[model samples]
Target chain A: MHDARYGWSSVHRCPSRHSDGERPRPARPGGGLTVPTIETRGLTKSFGDVDAVLDLDLTIEAGEVFGFLGPNGAGKSTTINLLLDYIRPTSGSVEVFGMDAQRHPAKIRERVGVLPEGYGFDDPLTGREYLDWAIGTKDADDDPAALLDLVSLTDDAGRMAADYSKGMQQRLAFAMALVDDPDLLILDEPSTGLDPNGVRTMRENVADVAADGTTVFFSSHHLAEVEAVCDRVGVMNEGELVAVDSIDGLRDTVGGHAAIELECATPPTELGVEALDGVVDVAVEDHTLTVTCVDPGRKIDVVTHVAERADVVDILSTTVSLETLFNELTEGGREGGGETTAEVAQ
Target chain B: MSIDSVLSKDLTSVRRSGALWGVAVCLTMLATMVAYVNIGRGAPPLREAQDAYGLLAGLVGVLVPIVAIVASYMSITGERASGGIKFLLAFPNTRRDVFAGKLLSRLAVVGVIVLFMFVAATAITVAKYGVLPVGVAVGVFAVSLVYAWAFVALSVAFSSATASRSQAIAAAVGSYFLLVILNLTFRFSQVVRLVYDTILGLGENPHLYAAADYVSPYIAYQKAANLVYPAAMERQVFRLPEEARETLPVYLTDEFSLVVFAAWLVVPLALGYLRFQRSDLQ
Candidate 1:
C-alpha cells in the first residue's frame, strides 16, 4: 500500500495501456493493502514458433516470499524477463506495485531490485564500485560497505570483480540489488554457482531482506530452497502456469496422500488392505508394505491393521518432498519417455 | 533514461580497466616517439613550426585511427558477449541511454588521447621552432578530434551491430582497411579502379582513385587540414598531387570533408543505436 512518506509513485502514474472511457484509479495509492507486489494477467510471450510464456495470471503479495519454480523450458526466465520488461510481451499486461511494467519500466525498475540470470559484471569495477554504481543508477543513498556486509563480501569489496569467484560474484550481485532499499526483490536463480555454504548464506540473506517488509519474488529450479524460503510457489510447464500453491498444499494436491512404508515379517494381502480407512492405494513388494494414506487421523489404524494382520517390524511415515511433487506436477517426462535433453533443458 | 548515470558508470569502468589505460599510455608514447623522429631527425630538418606541425599532423592522422580501432573495437561487443550489457540495462537505463552513454564516454576517451598527442606535438613544435602557430595547432587539434570521433563512431557501430567480439574486431579491421588504407596504397586504389571500370558498367575514369579518396574519412581529414593551412602545409605533408585531386568535384571538395566526418559520426551511431535498442540482449 500507500505510505505518504514514500509518496505516490508519480513517475509510473501514466494512464493504463487499455484505458477505456473512464480510468479506474488503482487502490494502492489510496492506502489500501490489496495491491500486490507483482501481478500479471493473461501475460504471454512468443519467440517465433516457440511460445515461451503463454496466457498466465500471477499475483504475489507484499512482504511475501514467492518462489517461481519450473522444470527446464518451463518459461521461468521468460516470465522474469517479462516482469522486468526486458522484452515486450506478445499480449496481456504486467504490473509491479500497481504500475504497468511495460508502460513504466524505468519507474518499476527504480523500486525493484533485480539479479537477472545470465548477466555478467563489469570486469574493472571493484565490489564497492559496483555497489556504488547501482546506488547511482537507482539515485538512492546507500553505503557500499553495508551492502557488501550484507552479502558477506565486505572484506573483498575493494577487489576487482574479475578476480572474484563465481559465488562471490553472485553475492556481489545480491548486494547490488539491495542498493536502493527496494520495495521488491526479483532474484532469478540466486543460488546458482554457489557452494553448499554459499547457498545457506544466500538463503539467510533472502530471509533477512524479506523480514524488512520487502517482497521477495525469486525463481529457482532447486526445490528444497523454494520449500524452505517461499510462502507460496508457482510452477510453470510448457509456457503455462501449471501449479501455484504453498509447498504442503502442492504436495496435498493429488489427495494429500501420506506414504507409509513398513518392514513386514510376511507378505500382506491386498483385499483387507484396500478397505482400510483413508488408504487411497496400497501395494506390497519385497517384504515392504507401502500405503498411500490420505488421512493422518487414520494413519495409526493402518499401522494397527498391518501390525495385527501381518507382523510389522517397522513403520515409517514419509511426507512427499517438494522435489517429488514438482517432478510429478510438471513435465518431467515420466509419461512420455522420448523427451530429449534439449526439450528438457529449455 | 539516465544518461548521466550510464556515462558515469561507463567512465568509471573504462578508467579502471588496465587495458584502456595501457592503450592510452602506449598511444601517447608512440605519438611522442614518432613526433621526435619526424621533426628532430634528418640532415636539413623540417624546423618550421607549421612544417613540423604538418609532419606531426601526418603522424597523428595515422596514429589516431590505429588507437581508435584498438580502443573501441570491442567496446560494446565484448560486454554483450560477456553478458554484461544485460547487467547495465538491468538498471534505470533504456538501451538508447546505454548507447548514448557509451558514445559520449568513449568519445571522451579518444578525445583525451588526441588531446595528449596534440598537446605534446604543439609543445615539441613550439620548443624546436620558437613559435606556436596557435591557429594551426587549434585547427589540427580540432581536426584530429573529429578524425578520432569518426573512427570511434565506426568502431562503436561495429561493436554494437555485431553479435560477438571477434566479429566486432573483424568489422573494425575491415573498416580500417576500407577508410584508412584504400587510398594510401596504390595497389588498393588500382584494385578499386579495376572493380569499378572492368567489373561494373561505369566508364573508365582515370579519377577513380580520387573518388575513392573522397569517400575515405582519413583522406577527408588530410584534405581538410590542407584546405585550412594549404600554403604552410604544402611542403609539410608528403603527397603527390594528382590531376584528379585538382579536378575533384564541388561535392568532394575540402568543405565536404566535414560532411563526410559528420555522416561517419551520425549515421553509424544512429544505425547502431536502433539495432542495439531493438535486439534482445541475451
Candidate 2:
C-alpha cells in the first residue's frame, strides 16, 4: 500500500474524476509531486586551509540510483557529512526532499536512512538487541529477527557485536539502516569489508529498496560495483565534482571513440589503414586489421575499402569501458573540460 | 523524538560493565573498613549519636567523587572517539539530545553506586552501634550526593569540551586531584594575593585561606555535612588548638559551602552545554 503519510496521495497511480465535472485523468508521478530528492548549490566546506568540498552543485531525482564516486581524500566523506549536517558547510546551500538540510536536519533524517563512514557499534549489544534499540529510536515497526534475516545474520543475532567479524559488522549496520523503511538511503561505503557474495547480495537489496520509490545516494570507491548498479555516476576529485553522467554517456564523452577490428581472408596488399580518414593507431596482426576511429561516420568507408582488397571474414566495433573512462576522467579530468561535462540530473 | 533509547543503551552498557562494578565493590568494601575502624576502635561519640556516622560522611566525601568521576569521565568523548556519536547524529538526534541523555546516564550510574554504598554503610553502622543517627546519616548522604553530582557535571563538562578520549581522561583525573586537594588552588591563590599586595603597596591580607576554600569539592562536602550535623562535627574539630582554628575564614560557613557546591553543579554543566552545542562535531 502506498501511504499518503510519505508525501504520496490516495489517488496515486489511479485515474480519477475531479470535482466540478472535470474529466477523468490518470494521477501524476507521486500525485504531481516531482521534487528532487536532494539538491545542492555551490556547497563548499573548508577545514582550516584545506577545502574538503568546493562549489559542488548536484541534484538527484526521486527513485534515482545515484552513485557518488571518488577516491580517498577526494572529499567523498566530507560531502556526505555536509549532506547529513554532521558538519555545516562553509558556504552555499543544500536541500533534501525540498527541505533545507541544515535547518531541518531532524526532519530530513527522519526520512533518510544512513550508513555513515567510520561508524562503530555499541560493542556489548547483541545484534538483535542493537537492532531493537535502533528500531526504538527510529520509531518504526520492525522485527529485529526480520531485519537480521535480511542481512543473513539471524543465527548470530544473539551474539555480542564485539564478537562479530568485520563483514558481519557491516551487514549488521546495513540491517540497522533499513529499520525506518526510509524514503532516501544515504550509504557511504556500505560495501566495505563485504565478501564478493555479500556485495552481490547488497546490490540486489539496494535494487529492491529503490524499486519502492526510495532514492539511494550511494558512495563507494568500488568502481565495479558502481558500474554494475548505478543509473548515473557522479565523480569527485580533490574537493571538486568532476563529472556526472550515465555510464554510456561518460564513456562516449571520455575517449570512448569507436574502434574497428577486421579479420580478412587474406593479408591485404597496401592495407594502409592509417592513410584512410578517421583511423589512428592502426595495427595488423594474425591477418587482422585494427584501428581507432575518431570520426565514426567513416567506419563504413574503412570497412568498404578493406572488403575490396580481401573478403572481410569478421568486423567488430568496441568503445571504452567505464573502468577505463573512470581512470581517464579522474586522472586528467580538469585538463579535459571536466567542469563543463558535469550534468545536473534533476 | 525522545532520547530514551540512548539513555537506556547507556544504562544497560554501564550495568554490564564488570570493571565499573569492580570499582563500585572496592569502594563499598573500603567504606565497610572505615566503618569498622570507627566502631571497633570505639571512637568518641557525637551528641546523641556515634561519631561513626561522621566517619561515614567523611568516607563519602573522600570516595563518592571518585565514583562520580569514573562514571562519566568519557561519556561523550568516548562515543565521539569511537564514531558512535555520528550514528546518533545521523539519526533524528541533535547534540543537545546527546548532552541531556548522557548527563542522565551518568547520573543514573553514579547515583546507584553511591546510594547503594551509603545504604550498606548505614546498615553496618547500625549493627555495630546501638543507635543510628538516621537524621544526620540521611542528611550527610544527601549532601554527599549533591557533591557527587558536582563531580558528575564537571566530568561531563570536560568530556564534552575535548575531542580526544585520552585527553578527556587526563583532564578528568587531573581535576580529581585538584578537586580533592583543593587547598592547592587556595594556596596558589594566596601567592597571587601576596604578590599583588606587594606590588600595589597594599599589605597585610588576612583572609586568603577563606578564598582558597572554594577550590575543593571535598571541603564543600565536609562543611555541608558538618553544618547539617554540627554536634558530630564539633566533637571532631574542638580537639584542634584554639588559635590554630580560631582564624578560620568567614566564608567557611554552611551557607557559603552550599553556595560553592551549587556553583560546581551549575557552572560546569552550563558551560559544557553551551560549548557542546557550539562545537562542530566531526
Candidate 3:
C-alpha cells in the first residue's frame, strides 16, 4: 500500500542489532508481523484557513534513520506533532508500532522518545533533574551521568536548565530524548541551535541509537547533516512532501549532473558543446571552458569534444549536491514546472 | 507513576516560585491580624474565641478564593505559552496525567496557605483568649479548604480551556469579580433573581431568591461556615423570614451549599479537561 513516489520499496532497513542488552525491547502492540516503526496515511492538519500539513503518507521501518527534510514553515514540526499526537490530525490517522497514535498515545509514547521543537525547560530544574524526570516518567533505569556524557553536558548537569545556553539546552534535551533506550526517536530540527561540535555529537548519537535497533525519524532543513546520517530523506515544501528517495536515488531522480570546469591551454573558439546531447549549458571565461551537463556520463563527451576543438590541459568536476536537488524539488520544480521527476516517478 | 512524576516535578517548580511564597506570607499576615483584632475585642474568653473563629471565617472566605485563583490560573497556560508543556508531554505521560498533576499540585500549594491561615488563627486565638473553639475552628478549616479547592478548580479549568495567557487571565479576573466581589455586593444574586423571576414568573418567592443567592461559591461558603459557627448566619445576603427559616427548602439549606461547592469543584474541571484533551498544544 506504500506510495511508489515515496520510494519506500528501495528503503534499506539495517539489520536489527540490540546492542544494549540491559534495555528491554518494547513490546509491539500487535504481535505477529513486523510493523513499520511509524506510518501515517493521508495525514492532514489545518490551522483555521491554512493547512499546516497535507496528505502525508510515510512509512519508516525499524532501524532506519529517515530524514524529514523541509525548509522553514514546510510543516516538518507539524507532521512530528501529528505523529506524537501532540496535535490531532484534521482528517487522517497515524500509527506507531502498529497502534493508532491518537487512540493510544501514551502507550505509543511509552516506546517513543521525542525532542520537540521550541521546547522550554521548567525554571530552576537542573539538567540532571530534567533527565531524572524523563527517566522516571518513562520508568527507565538509564544512568543520568552516561546520558550527560553522551551529549557532552557532564559538567553542566548540575546547573539549572533555565540558565543553560541555547546549545547547552539543545544538548540537554537530546540527552533526555535518549533516556530509556527508546524504540523510536523523533527529533525535530535537533541541530537548529547547535555548534559544529554539538551537531557532530547529535549525528553520532543518532547513529549510535540507530545501530541499537532504534527507528530514528529526524527532521531538519540542514541538508549536510541529513545527507550525512539519513538512510533516506523525504523532502517537504509548503505543507506537501515533494520527494522521497535514497541520497543517490534523489541525485538520480533530479537528473544527477556534474559541472566540469576544464582549464584549457587556449580558450575554445567556436566550441559547439552546447549542441551536444545532454549538454545543458556552456560558457568560456579566459582560459577556462565550463560545461554543465544533465547527465554525469556526458562529462567525458564534453571533454572529448573540447579536446578536438582546442588543447585540453586540466579538468575539475563537481557533482550535484543535495542543496541543488532540494532547491530544484522545492523551489523551481514546484511552481512553474507542471511535474517534477518525483511526480513522474510515481 | 506518570501522575506522581508530574505532580512532584510541578511541586518542586511551584515551591521555588516567589509568587506562592508571596501569597502565603500575605495570607498568614492577614489571618494573624484578623485573629489579633477579633480576640482583642475583650469579652469572655470563650465568647471571644468563638468570635475570633467567626471573623477568621470571613477573612478566609474572601482571601482563600483570591489566593487559589492567583496560584492556579496560569498553571497550564503559562507552561503552554512558554513552551514548557512540550517538554512535559515529551515523555509517556498522557494529557490526563498533566491535567491531574497540575490540579493536585496547585491544590497542594493553596492547601498549604489554607492550612497556614488556620494554624496562625488558632495560635493567636489560643494565646489571647486562653480558650479555643476547637469544633468551630476545625469545621471552618474543612470548609475553607473545600472553598479554596473549588476556586482552584475553576481557575485551572480556565487555564486548560484557554489557548493563551491573556485569555486565561481574563477568565480568571472576570470570574473573581462575578463570583466573589459582585457576589459579596449581592449584585450576582440580584441578577440571578431578576432572570429567575422574569423567566419562571415566580414572583415574591423567598425560597427561590435564597436559592439564587446560594449559587455563588462565595455565598455557599458562608452558608457552610454558618453551619459550624452560627455567627456567620447574620452575614447572609438573602435572609428568610423566621418562619421560613425553620421550614427551609432543601436547596436553601446549609447542607445544599456543600452540593454547590462540589459542583463548583467538578463542573469546571470536567469542561476544562474536555477542552484540554482535544486541544493541539502548539
Highest lDDT scorer? 3
Per-residue alpha-carbon lDDT of model 3 for B139-194, expressed as tens digits?
Answer: 88999999999999999999998878899889989999988898776555567567
Residue-wise C-alpha lDDT for candidate 2, range B108-218, written one tens digit per residue: 788877887777777777776666777787787788788899999999998888889789989888987877754423444455466757766676454553456445777
Clashing pairs in 2: B186-B212
Instruction: List CA RMSD, all candidates.
Output: 7.5, 7.0, 5.8
Q: Model 2, range A1-346, lDDT digits (tens) per residue?
A: 1222222222111112122222222222565556688899999999999999999999987666788998888888998988888888899999998889878887887889888888877647888887887888888898888888889999999999868988898898889888888888989998999999999888878876765656788998777777666667899988999788866567667453566889888865567766775554466787788765665676888898888778899998776456645664566444543332332110
lDDT of 1 by residue, A1-346 (tens): 2123222212122213213322223234545346777899999898998999999999887666788998778899999888887777889999998889867777788888989888887557888888888888888888877788878898998898878999999999888888788888999999999999999888877776765557788898877777776767898888988788866567577445567888887776653876765675566888888776665666788888877778778888886455755775576534431332223333
What is the overall TM-score of model 2 with all chains considered together? Answer: 0.82
Looking at the true structure's interface, with contacts defined as alpha carbon pairs within 8 Å between chains A and B, what fraction does model 1 recover?
Answer: 0.58
Residue A186 in model 1: lDDT:
94
**Fraction of true inter-chain Cα contacts (below 8 Å) kept per model?**
0.58, 0.65, 0.76
Off by over 4 Å in 3: A1-32, A255-293, A296-318, A339-346, B39-42, B193-203, B231-235, B239-247
Worst 10 residues of 3 chain B by lDDT: B230-239
Model 2: lDDT to the true structure: 0.75
Worst 10 residues of 1 chain B by lDDT: B232-241
Measured by TM-score, the strongest candidate is 3
